[model samples]
Target: MQRQLIQPYLLVLGIALTLSSCFNEPNYPDTPSADFKGIFKYTIAAGTGVGAAKRDSVVLTIGFKDGDGNLGNDIPVPKADSARYAQNGGWGNYQIRTFRLINKQYVELVQDVNKVLFFPDLTKGKPKGAIEGTIDFRQIFTYGSSFKMYPTKFQIKIRDRSLNESNVVETDTISVPFPN
Candidate 1:
């Protein structure tokens, strides 16, 4: 009887140890800092419409450093000047609030109808229901190009949610270099 109890305890302890060790971070990234060079500019573009007409540019630039904790000037991202969303559900019920990058893989462009504060919902107040309009996701990645230049590409995705009227616009990407 004691042997049976011991086996179960050992098994549990083994699992706990394994789980803890799984959290150990690995020092490997698909797009390592070494893979890039010189000034890298990440920009948030306004695809179309009044948002495009009223484009508020935000850019980030990385100086001459191979990831040794060095960030340089902020350069504007390439402007698409071709992205526009037509009003589908309401009458001029859209307001571009914020443009943010979520994690290392998501760039979100928000358009809230009700002008809801995304902080309370996205950060602290995660609503379970829906949100208004749609969010576009953009990713910037290097195509393993030349040594002097790592040409980047931007990928875009349109995602729509349901809610009364919340203005939260974000355009994010995972391919962009993360700030240390």
Candidate 2:
């Protein structure tokens, strides 16, 4: 009876020790940082006026790290209250800039309408700690009939709740096709 009890206690202790050793807290900078992981392009049908238009869509995967884990917005600000948050970089915590290769130079492509994106609170209902993860951002482009294909890339960065901007990382150049 004594040997059986001792054996069980030892087994439990060994498991606890193993689990503790396997999980080590991550240490990272308080400022959020991001890296371009990959880029994927695909053709999707858009609109149904006469026939569906084939549009090119690209998904950019970015890896990010934040020490304090305050890398996203907890709640969306209502449209009426958006003015108040404008000073704090608006409601979006994730910022993106699109660039297209033109004449061997990369020029920033400004959209007719601003597209704002925000990431959800990463530490929702959990204790704050260092966190790292990847996010995929998708964008669809309707090219003009004048261009058949173009080389494009994007610059990505992330902002923490504290308004600290991360280092900007650029994706590899990809040839985007425009379907007629």
Candidate 3:
């Protein structure tokens, strides 16, 4: 009798687990939702190194924001909007995935068609977009940082610099009237 009850419970648990996993995340496609459009900005909180040369940030003017709000233009990294080391030399690298309004949760800023840095990783969490992380300088002329970006209101959280320390940003909601 006990074995019969145990088997049923085990079966139920297995099924529940499978179903829960599926429903936990919203279904999202690579393409943006139809009618979705906007020019959302992702601002990063700059980092600094102890002994590296300092430089100015280029103040990148992001170009295209698609229907689903995926960014498809080169963020003009002018000579100005780069890292400024405190001393001789260090590098900083940053990758920003430009957008999903609801599903994938961001407007991806993709300059290259061959690579993806964030949100696409559905294996980790729900596809609601993210701001990956941050980096001061992995080497000279390179600032290594990535984060999962979220739409609705610009918020910078979960900073990951150099595969080490991180600080996630806090945020509140901003209502955007749905488009007709």
Candidate maximizing lDDT:
2
Ranked by lDDT, the better of candidates 2 and 3 is 2
Q: Global lDDT of each model?
A: 0.29, 0.78, 0.30
lDDT of 1 by residue, 1-180 (tens): 899989999999999999998874333322112111122345545355443422222232211111111111112311221121123333221223323444543344433432321111121233232222212222232222221221123222211222133222222322333223
> Model 1: number of clashes?
28
Question: Cα deviation in Å at residue 147, candidate 2?
Answer: 4.5
Poorly placed runs, candidate 2 (over 4 Å): 50-52, 78-85, 89-91, 112-115, 143-147, 177-180
**C-alpha RMSD for every candidate:** 18.3, 3.1, 17.5
Off by over 4 Å in 3: 3-24, 32-52, 56-180
Worst 10 residues of 3 by lDDT: 133-142
Q: Which one is best on TM-score?
A: 2
Point out the worst 10-residue segment of candidate 2 by lDDT.
77-86
Candidates 1 and 3, the one with greater lDDT? 3
**Candidate 3 lDDT by residue in tens digits, 50-165:** 53433222221221111222212223323432233111123222233223356746543333521322222112333334222211211111123332323443222111121221
Sort the candidates on TM-score, descending order.
2, 1, 3
Better model by TM-score, 2 or 3? 2
Candidates ranked by lDDT, best first?
A: 2, 3, 1
Model 1 residue 34 CA deviation (Å) reads: 20
